[model samples]
Target: MSSPIALHTIQYNTQDIDNDTLILLYKNLLKPRLIEEKMLVLLRQGKISKWFSGIGQEAISVGVTMAMNMDEYILPMHRNLGVFTTREIPLSRLFAQWQGKASGFTKGRDRSFHFGTQEFKIIGMISHLGPQLGVADGIALASNLKNKNQVTAVFSGEGGTSEGDFHEALNVASVWQLPVLFCIENNGYGLSTPTNEQYRCEHIADKGIGYGMESHIIDGNNILEVFTRVTAIADSMRQSPRPILLEFKTFRMRGHEEASGTKYIPQELMDTWASKDPVINFQTFLKDQGVLNESLEIAIKEDIISEINTHLKIAFDEDDIVPDKTNELNDVYKSFEYQEIEKKPETNQLRLIDAISDGLKQSMERHHDLVIMGQDIAEYGGAFKITEGFVKQFGKERVRNTPICESAIVEVAMGLSIAGMKSVVEMQFADFVSSGFNPIVNYLAKSHYRWGQQADVVIRMPCGAGVGAGPFHSQTNEAWFTKTPGLKVVYPAFPYDAKGLLATAINDPNPVLFFEHKGLYRSIRQEVPIDYYTLPFGKASVLRKGDDVTIISYGAAVHWALETLDNNLDIQADVIDLRTLQPLDTETIYTSVKKTGRAIILQEDSLFGGIGSDISALIMEHCFEYLDAPVKRVASLETPIPFLKQLEEQYLPKNTFESELKSLLEY
Candidate 1:
């Protein structure tokens, strides 16, 4: 029900500048305008590319930064050349960033304005639109866990409010009541489509009404008004344990990026919006206050020009790229193999989900910096009830309940993980994870390679068939993540194994997706170890070792294999659990296949381009010498999972999906 966010109006004089002397209120507004104007000019001249300039949105950025303490976190997008500059990114270095120069960040290796200074508490900028809101919440949520007073401020454009991530981030923030400010730069157009045309809503600010958030829409050009309201909200948000939504009505003086020319924009409207430009309007306000004299104005202009030139010089001087730096691209997009319980001693006392849940709970206990947030995961204890009583144990501060925005949850978790905390984000259902694919594939998967960074995030998706939950509820899309590189996918069929793997994933330096089959939670129960035990990734397990043929699968398929074996009419199959699908246990799979001289892959997911396909490819590449009958597979039909029970049963892989095994046994 939430719509695009906007700002509310407020008025104040310089006295409301947080009772501080060094940082002036008008100066905060002045700084944003000065820097943003330079950035716009750069964009206009082709000196800058991908500029989301804050031309008319200066007040919001200035106000937010002013409201924030120096130690509080601020996550800004490309538009906030103003935001970053106000927080201490040297103007020259900031300008050098537009030139893609080394003197900026990583000697210019990072995307423009995408790098954050740890000292300034600017976690970083995310250009992938609404995703940063989650990241900001992550920082705020972490601060809460650490029992710190720091609040994180996240800024985005009105265009981004339409994105799922924006809503996702906002919902989570509201539920957790984290000390964060969600500001929307509501500049009428999301690349020429009016906000009204693309969306239906009274106001983006009003959108926060449903989720326990305090919402406001400000005249974005009003600097004094912005600073006063933001200062009060940022100061009070921590006490209420809630987030605030401020929509700043502004307009872009230039195109979306550097090249779009605003061809779709009507000139009259453009001129009218421009007439309320933040920089010009604020300057007039300063003049009225006797603060804008010729000497002071000249000084500010000269300072900006000098800073830009300095940055340009640094950029040109060190703009050289390493010959092989770009070559590292391939590894950045690769995924790892899913492994089972490693060399750790095997015990007969554990089930998979129990193991995973224990691991999640234990890891969170060990690392106070780790946060586990999901829908109804706190008091309701998760749909599978994995986190039962965690709200009482961990408190609602650490165990969060979020609105259903799976994609934004993943993004926020990733951003928080990247900013120095471990995050476990849960999807109530595995089938719902598709909502998060945009940031997961385009950003999280490549961030380490792109930024030489690592974000530790665990996504627990309750997946699979057989729960009678129908099409939308039952899905095993681990392979979708399997296909994407830089993601570690784990599908643990047993409880104990699940706990250990979940723990390892929590501690690992990269992103890990842990899928729990909702159908398996109660079906396979065992008493897991009371103490901590870890399972290494990329290690497969031989469930029932056999020599006739190898049956490889994970999650419910492993259970199906056991049932199929119990009803045996086929060859003795060596069933292996691909515990972690990515970073696959090739040696175990290949060795088993080689010894058996036959292999039958089984999975509940569709047949085409799945983890099974990857397993086949690996077997073909390594164990071809051991093949007896063109590596057979038993899987579901390549079609949508049906709503009708009969059709769903017909479409899914069942225990009877043993044609390959039966034929081999007959032979």
Candidate 2:
């Protein structure tokens, strides 16, 4: 093996700190190192499936955690065992989490440091790593909004800095001047890939300068330096709200995980890092300063070992979590029943856009903690002008404008929801949701099931074709979110349903994808009540009742079904408008299908894998015995929406619903 370059020592001053505080920091560092040693034994014995060793990087986690106030939030990555230990989370519960037992933070739903506890003010990172940066921005944003003077500290690896989310999150934090400490643990290797391969910048902190934020690089292996600098920087941030980037240079002493060997790393480099081991180096320093002696060090090690054995025994005695299909399915979403609106008021004729605006305004007035954000949503209103004049009424904080960053904003909404606030994210168009899909599906959707965290967010998606806006701006992609678990999908056809259902969506304790058909925003008008109201999800609205055949649809397709029935009075049919897709109104669908003895499902999305396919399968499975013919499906072509008016009209399912309804009625 080639000889490796020696690492430089970081200068630090600890004369100001008292002996007790310094000893406590040493204990915190030693605890995780010993616990990791025990876990390595468990991994070898096949008791634990995997282990991500933070053996040498303990100083970074311990120092940063000890420096921050207990109430301040921290979002940590996988290799942050010291963060949990320093925060005083029970070892028994943590062991149970590793053992996949019931008492764990996620109830055995997730593994590793992938779980979060609101009680400890720690939000765990998802596998993607980058989203947590945005989530930290959200927590800080909430703290800023409430004037709580709270600061958020978020951690990431040197490799994670390369992700787009890192840039988006840093840019947003810089623009808003949110109080967040962006800590990058530069551990030299990201799963065998070295730092040089990750980016061209001199240091990870350099990226922060591009975002117009103060940046710093510190020696992560030095415990005193880590603690002192982080404490001072965090204190400064609390009094004056702003984002700061901190790059801590450290080395990963072990492989990414135990299973992934260190063969990729040079033997000499590993040896070079071994000499500067944070835990050993700190112990030696403490002994030299007369703060710790050989006997005292031995006593602390013995105590930590005893504590680990006790917790491991408790975790071992716990019953294994056997999976139950029914229980697993039930836990996918939070149990929230339909709520009824209290009072009724006089009605006024309004367009779908106006009704949505009224609903948002009323929701904001009702819930003071509610925040709505989107590009051009505040001063310029929205693309559809749905939130026009909202900033004037609610102020810029509640009704804010966001940069063209869909992914980061979605995660920010999740973070806001995490901090006990309701948030609504508006995508300029439904097609734009693709950019924000990761956090929505992997994090926000699974938060409740995984860690009992409620992401009370409403994402407004302006959808549908026929407007000649082309594929990018115009698309009915409700099916995209409908297939994912833990999200409520709502698409209303008229002004009354739009207003009522939107109110309900805003109040839902889970993430909701509310699709507003841009094509119907101005084309349709109805008598909508000025007072706040709510409609139940998972309950389809029967727009028209007939017995010949059942025609079911949602969003713009519901209007097409009514139009078809209006034109063909002879073709009597039951038309059902599904308000929500995920919590589907299968009861209404089955009843209508059984009574009519036939069914025709319609959708604005393409035929294959669309929501109509699911509806058809359900009807055939439950109501097949009463069927007169096969369940028919009318939908747009399986192709991208066109920009030309003529092609868009042809691409829409409105022109085909009438023909399909007649065919089903005849059969």
Candidate 3:
């Protein structure tokens, strides 16, 4: 026969926690298990659409929550109900959230563990598992910079450790010695993949050693053991401020969700884990220590059941939330009354890159919380040298040099934003953004709509095909972000627009993807304003007025459109520069199209699913009746930009813009 599992006994006096407190911890563990059971029941009754049961792993979350101070932040996963319960989240709110009711934290916008309370210092988890780890690292970084001794606890699964974000976040935290505790609940399986298939290491904590961080494994079934160990770790982290990865060896008794059947799990394995249930084990340990008797256990159970029942009744009685269709566009971008700052005529001409750098310097001087982060942004200035003198002026603390981790750059910005700091992230190249797409599209863009949280980050993307940078370094990928609801896309052509739009993006309360055209960075020079000023988003600049046709473009293509019109004076096209792609200037486009009675949309991105298609559809819907001819769309070919300079120029739509515009004018 196998030896029985060893129990970690707690000494009443030495641990500084009384028997009553231990019992309460046990209660915290049991309450979530009972609530999960109720959620499964509700799932069957169709009251809840889905359920993720943390049935066997409640001890880990509760222990970690009990160990940390109330002010410490926690980035929890979907299975972390114990963390919510220990933080005193009302049972009614949890039910309301699961039921998608108006009283829930998200006001029925999101369902199931996708809500957070800023007051409680908990950031809710998104569907993506790994990105939150990076967010935690950023929070820890901000806390350390602000001289706040707050430890951030982030939870993840063994499966999530395989993600790139897991590595990036740990690497950053280790290098910076940030105050973060990465709690990995090793629950034997990730949805359906077994641990043996996921990784070869004997313990998940072993990975932390490679990152130069201390790692430990704990008996996840023992609540007292978890609390005792985590309390010490939390205290040490607050003092010295280093990350520690804790791997809790536990099991998940239920399937990934109610809809996901448990037939894949073996009966023998289920029986083995059932014998080691955390809640039952904790109750037994308390009963053996004379802290919990049969009558007290019965009374505690009754009180919990009664409280849950009362909350459920209240939640069910609440009115169903009806989404306001009129406010669908609200919160997509920051809305504020427009008060234009006075601008003086400039005498000194600067390149677009210099203008942007100057704007960043001015913004950083004005806002103490502004931070700049990217690869080689500190000492080397950046790949484009746009941040050349930033480190010397702002110091390394404010202008940080990040590892080659793109996702973490955005994730850290999101974290800093949440912690009341503004951050600007730089993607080395537009193509490299594919590596960090999840944080931008899934988390940063949807944070406000899902949880009413502000991810006030500005990601600078150096885009457009020019200088023979080839496919990897040169590509205009703004359409990908423009399609996302919560993101604002800005592409400025002139130095004046570049400086002003960048300032506006930095000040906006929402996330912005500012695409800087590398081709125009040095080629375009203009006398930009010396002082701080912000141009409004969703406003277009009419570069030239004409009665023949309306030419709509942004970034480098706007210049191409202007040149085409200048060369063909008879074409007489109205060139409108769309400074912002998302929250597009539809009114301006419509007004110009109505006057010209013709339209031409030009872009540097590929034709397939490009921004031109969206613009064409918009004009067709709003200005179809005003058109004298079919709208024309001129864009790059649908292929990766070639390394050869001649082929690269051919891949761009600049040369084609003149011919397309002339054809539209003739028609």
Candidate 4:
């Protein structure tokens, strides 16, 4: 016969918690269980769409939530419904949220625990369980900076431990010594994959040893043990801020979701875990201790059922407000009216890099809540020395040097934004952005639309070719972000525009991708204002004016068009530089195209799926009647950026743009 499973219980005295608090914890535990049971019935009746049942793991959620203070933040997953209830979130609103009603937390945009409310200090988990760990680090970072002495608790499953984000978050948290309680609910499986197949480590707590973080194993099924252990750990962390990993050994009694059954789980394992159901075991323990009797248990059960019914009626009584196209379209981005700063006549001849650094310095002076985070940005001054004396001027608290962790740092920036602070994340190279793409597209881009939460963050991408840095280092990847709905993509050609546009991006109440062409950072020089100023987005700058033909471009491609026009004096054309790609200046393009009667869009990205493709389509759709000839697009070859100068020169459109422009002019 197999040995029986070991169970952990309260090792310390329980006298610290009074009788009333103990009973309150019990009530909190019972709330999610009863509510989940009722939700299952609703699901069966087709009243609800789907459900992720936390039927067996109520103790860990309730105990951890009860242990944390009201001011402290808790980021919980779908299996942690008890966290919401224990925090006193309105059950009616939660029901409305599940029903996709406008009165719910996400206002019908997202379902279940995918939304967060700042008022309750509870951050909802995204479908990706691991990113929340990084987000917790961000919140705790804010706490550390503000001297709040607050501890943040973030939860995940054993399955999430396999993700790179899990390791990055833990490493960064430990490196910064942030006060975070990483609670891992070891429910023995991730979806259908068993623990044996998931990891070779003996226990999840062993992962913490590599990170040099303190860890503990807990009986997740025991409410009293979870409560007492977490309480002690949180208290210690607040006094001496650091991260601790707590592995709550438990099991998932239901499938990953309602549709996926538990058939994959062995019958013996299921039978073993069924005997240790958190709700039933805790209730039995409470009864055995004389804290509850038959009459009290019956009364509590009746009251919970009545409460669930009352909330259900309120939720059902509110008419299901389906999301409309108009509202859905309008809510994609939050508008922050650009406040123009007083213009100063003082000017300095500076390079594009200098102008960017000056603009960042001025903005940091104006906004106290603004922070800069990137690898080697502080002491080492970043890859291109953009942040070179910022550490001394702004202090290490505001200008943080993160580890070589692009994914976690980006999510950390979002966390800072969630705390009502502005953050600037400098990508060492534009190609490195692929590591942090998930948070930018999924979390930051969808934040406002999903929950009316603006991500006041900026990601500075140093991009472009011509330095012979090869494919990885030199890539015009601006097209990747232009297609994303919530992101504002900005690319400047000159020093003056670089400074003004960067200032605007930092203050905008939305996520912005600021691309700086490294080729022009030092090569381009102009007189830029030393004082703070803002430039309006979705506005095109006409560098030169002519009536023969219109040449439209941005970034380094703009300069190439201007040079081509200057050289070929016979070919008079209006050169338009699109400063921002997301909020595109279509009006300027249309007006210029109508006047010139011809247009050629130029870009450094490959020919296929470039931003130029969309511009070409728009011109055809809107300016078809005004065009004298077919709209042309001049772009790089449909291949990776070449390494050799001769091949690269041939690959990019700069050398070929003049020919394309002449062809369009002739037609």
lDDT (CA) per prediction = 0.74, 0.90, 0.88, 0.90
List per-candidate RMSD values in Å.
5.6, 2.4, 2.6, 2.7
Ranking by TM-score: 2, 4, 3, 1
Q: Is candidate 1 or candidate 4 better by TM-score?
A: 4
| Structural similarity to truth (TM-score) of each candidate | 0.84, 0.98, 0.96, 0.97
- The alpha-carbon deviation from the true structure for residue 284 of candidate 1, after best TM-score superposition, in angstroms, is 5.4
Where model 2 places Cα greater than 4 Å from the true spot, the runs are 1-12, 342-345
Q: Model 4, residue 599: what's the lDDT?
A: 94
Worst 10 residues of 1 by lDDT: 1-10
**Model 1, range 343-399, lDDT digits (tens) per residue?**
344445655656666677777789887778888898899887788978888888678
Write the residue-wise lDDT of candidate 3 on 158-271 in tens digits. 999998899999999998899999999999888899999999999999998899999999988778789999999999988899999999998888888867867889999987
For residues 1-667, what per-residue lDDT tens digits would candidate 4 score against the true structure? 1122343232323557776777798799989988998998899999888899888799899999999999899999999999999999999989999998878988787888999888888899889778888989988998998899999999999999999999999999999999999999999989999998989999999999999999999999888889998998999999999999999999998999989999999999988777777666666666666777879888988998998899999999998786588888888999778877755899999999999999898889989999999989998999999999999999999999999999999888888888778899999999999999998998999989998888889999999999988999999899999999999999999999989999999989899999999999999899988788989899999988999988999999999998898899998788999999989999999999999899999999998999999999999999999999999999999889988999989889998888888888788
The total of clashing pairs for model 1 equals 45
Error of 3 at 46 (Å): 1.8
TM-score (C-alpha, index-matched) for candidate 4: 0.97
